[model samples]
Target chain A: MEWDWAFVMQILPTLFEGVKITILATLLGSIVAAALGLVIAILRRSKYRLISMPTGFIAEFIRGTPLLVQLYFIFYVLPDMGITLAPLVAGVIGLGLHYGTYAAEVYRAGIENVARGQWEAAKACNLTAFQTWTRVILPQALPPMIPALANYFIAMFKETPLLSAITVLELMNQARSIANFNYRYIEPITLVGAFFLAISLISVIGLRWLERRYGRIG
Target chain B: MININRLGGAVSAAVLSSLLFAIPAKAEDTLEKLKEQGFARIAIANEPPFTAVNPDGTVSGAGPDVARAVFKKLGVNDVVASISEYGAMIPGLQAGRHDAVTAGLFMKPERCNAVAYSEPILCDAEAFLVKKGNPQGFKSYADIAKDSSATIGAPGGGTEERLSLEAGVPRDRVIVVPDGQSGLKMLQDGRIDVYSLPVLSINDLVKKANDPNIEVVAPVVGAPVYCDGAAFRKNDTALRDAFDKELAAMKQSGEFAKIIEPYGFSAEAAMSTTREKLCSASN
Candidate 1:
């Protein structure tokens, strides 16, 4: 019940190590999610049903399952199929895959928001399909998507705690270990909450700045 | 949107501030509360031989059996059981989630500081589950530490994890496997080099796993034999003392042995040590 400042100081380094892992996992997972989401959005919008239908089904399946169960399946169950991933790699992949499905919807909405006239204008400019997507469509579409992507990045940060179940030793896992070793819960748990709040608040401020800087479609 | 966000923050702040004054006022007598309720809620890890949940949905095993008998004598007619992890059991007791923990949670100095423990109810030695033929020839946690590639699996926050770390095994090499079952599976899958648990627990798991590739190494080197007591919150010292008295009487009457002996625990080992002796011993 008593908060021990000395104990807190002693454990801060260990917790900070965990914070580094948490941030690493979130950053890597966010990158994977963003790229994978674009792939999923592109495939789901394919002209052929043969490609788009299966892509849509796979995205929905990943979205439907719990992230924790998927992490377990990837970390523990995948070895049976002769695929073994290191814990951090497994955790990052799990988080990225799970959030990528949701991010795909955001990408789809961003792409759809581009006017039909923009596509026609690119065609009239004698641009190739790739040039049209890269120069005209995506440049306009990406700005509005920044805030939504930032929101998912923050969401992925919160979900990083679940990576502990697979033994990734992230921030919450570090706090639990400290609590278990010291038999003091209040301080470490409260510190974890504070850490999460501070990071989220910072991310929100950054998101607002991005929105103000790039939100205008024109 | 800003107003809603402000309101949500304000409400959460108010709630968090209110929790500062909301500590559950402990009743003067915990035993009296248990007696009035007619059932004592005890936490148990579903590790076989120490604590197990039967196929019939009943709780059994040496720990619960000893605890149930002691509580029954104290006029608590029933002992309801909640299956929890070894690390969470103590916090569960402190959080008022359980009346007692009889999950063979060993009485180490750090744990002794957390909860009031009754006299010893079960005594066990450390053991490791390794691949058959003991390919790595790992005899102790030190052996695992010496081998750079070896990964040892132990329950998170349990005594075995502490032992491995104390023996110089790096934190990364000591994989915190979730439970007994998962530890065995991890061993089978070659996910970890060794799975550490109590001797009886390893025996039980290896038997159930029925895998010829698995072998048990008992009395792990540099690890001491430890005993566990039914742990109660520090405020429940009166109830714990009463429970200890009843446990001593049961030991003397041969009733304690009759209950725990069937589960592969030595009643003599449990009776030999006092809680004070075990609690003061730093692991």
Candidate 2:
């Protein structure tokens, strides 16, 4: 009933403590996603059906199911199979694995967007496959990915709530617990939204700066 | 040598009687309406000691345990537990998301304005969960307030958060986790100094975690017990009354306590009166 500015002030500092966990999960999750995306992108381009076909299916399968279900599977079911991970570890892995499938498509699009003439030029220079990709194609292809990758970082920040399902007490979970105890969802939940908005606004501005920087590189 | 046909007819009749008596519905007018629809949808949060989603994806818990028995007695053959959050359970009922909530939703005055509750299925006191030795020596939220480093995990819209806040534990010190599992994990990992939750719910967490390091600090600060029960939309007064009648019968017969006690609850606890006089403001 009463909007206690002092109470909000008191709560804000504690939630700030959780920001480290939030940033850590998103940072670690994004790195895993980037690596996994690269692998899937390469697999999709492989000449062998054995490699490409199942890689595509696995990507589709991970994409098809809800991230929450995947999280539950990793946290609840995997332990029975003798695979165990801490809550945050399992959360980052599941979040990364799920989003990586989508990122693989982004990477695929970026790689494909590299002008066909560039590949021919690399060959004309007598460049090997690694040299051709590293020196010629990837340098051109990767810049466009910066915006999309930055976007994934933002998306991952929003998706941190899913980590709560796997028992990772990020910002939203903290808000929910506060709301539950106080019987006032309005304050704590509003604070969660405000916190999200604040972070997201900063991220969007930072990402725009990245996009512009990478746009010139393009 | 015997009349086999007669024996068969007599045996079938006895089985039918047993089944008929299992769930004694009001047979009041609405009973036919519910039966015509074919299923009684019960909302649940799927948390243990209250409602849980079984490994097979079926639902069970003290709340459902009592509800299921009452439904069986009411002749509601198909009782389904629909997943719903504790905060949303009342709204879900009001919006017709389900016929009723079988979760451990407390019957507070605020909730009473929106929904009617059946007799309390389980009465639980709020309590603090601490490390095995209780290294911080937490007797209540005062202990938490004394320590600047102390943090508590209280799920959203749960009573623990309220108690902690009321005790002057800063809003920041209380981590509003989404569920008991995370709260317990946070406590285990030392990310939280204490986890304040329903004694029963925390007990369920301790059992589920099966960790030796965590234990319940008896009778949480400020209150002895809170009454939690099945809630129905205020408009469903008839259904609420029917449920109450059957639940009262169950309690009187001692069947309610028998069914729920195994889930780390006391049948006597449920039977205890929830008179306001009994609920004290200070510990």
Candidate 3:
């Protein structure tokens, strides 16, 4: 079918609502990934093998599996065990848990990039372990990791369409619904492509800005 | 972002070329092509009675059985079936992904306008698969819409979803369940208050599940009984008409009744309605 511009205009408002949910899922998922990754990284680095081994395996497991299957487990399987989450909550959890493992790797690299001398110097200064991590190592480690972590979040943003599997009304889902109803894919699907391209372009610019702000290792 | 730019460029190029090729196309050759190809591609929903896939991976059920017989009569050797969601069938036909959709994708004015539909094939009324008691007392789409907390699930892009929307349920409230089994799971999980589909499809799922916790409410209030036809691409009217001719003869010869009745579809219901009447009926 020919591209119907009018149909595009008509469906934009509905699609924009979907875009809002997509952005919300991405933003919330990014926050979860950032926090959870730090916890996993710290746990995996623990002196006790009991904690570290399981933590490492879990992270590996989460990273090793497909996000879509994980989403189905969270959305469908978990409910049978009496833990029912709303569609958005389950989607965000899936997105965060899957990406958090990758983020943990980034965390490990960033922390390792902090030289041993810095830790020894913090110990010599009589600073506590918390102080060493917070004041010295983190300040040094975090800046360079921003670009890598931001890259994951942007990647996560593109993958948000998978949320539709569990019935999150994200952009791709909304576009499909519109196309299904109208029996016209040319406009709705093309609009979805346009929306995704525009958003990714904008996010890439933001990533560049983030890189400029926190990119330097020194 | 560069990839996005490439995607945008590629989409535009594809759309432009399609437009260029839209006219001066070859004429009435789809049937000829299918006959030569040995099999007509047909879309089925995998929802039983209407359409189903067997354990051996062969396709059967009333819709495909009828379509297969019609194609065999049309001199095509076999019908190749693909399981598709109801919503994708029309677009799939348009995209040349399938020759015709034998899925119980009900005929509506919008769908009638979109595809070349053969005379109506399978007919059924809407039904809800709700909690054992149907505690919310939902007998109709309007009932679910009126209850603000109530959520209903239907197969994505299916007629039940459209009916729910038309009945004034908010978009967020009408969950697009992926399939019959999932819909039943969602119902048991209490993720959705009601799951809707054709009456027979729901019965088939409930019977398979043997779940006492669920019940079916058939002939949903104010929702008229609807029928589905094998949908061909808009430009494939010649193929549709040829298929229709075979189908009409089968109906006249009692073959159609024998093929469909064992699957629990009422042959008279389908035979009594005309596409013009269903398509022009006020929604």
Off by over 4 Å in 1: A124-126, A216-218, B1-27, B55-57
- Residue A36's lDDT within candidate 1 is 94
Docking level for model 3: medium
| lDDT, residue A59, model 2 | 98
* Candidate 2 second chain TM: 0.80
Clashing pairs in 3: none
lDDT for position B127 in model 3: 94
Candidate 2 lands at a TM-score of 0.67
How much lDDT does candidate 3 score? Answer: 0.90
DockQ of 1: 0.55
Instruction: Give one digit per residue, the lDDT tens place, for model 1 in B161-279.
Output: 88898899987788877889878877887778899999999999988888888899998988889999999999899999999899999999999999999899999999999999999
Candidates by TM-score, descending order: 3, 1, 2
Give the DockQ ranking, best first. 3, 1, 2
CA lDDT, every prediction? 0.90, 0.76, 0.90
User: What range of 10 consecutive residues in model 1 chain A has the weakest lDDT sum?
Assistant: A209-218
lDDT of 1 by residue, A39-66 (tens): 9998999999999999999999999999
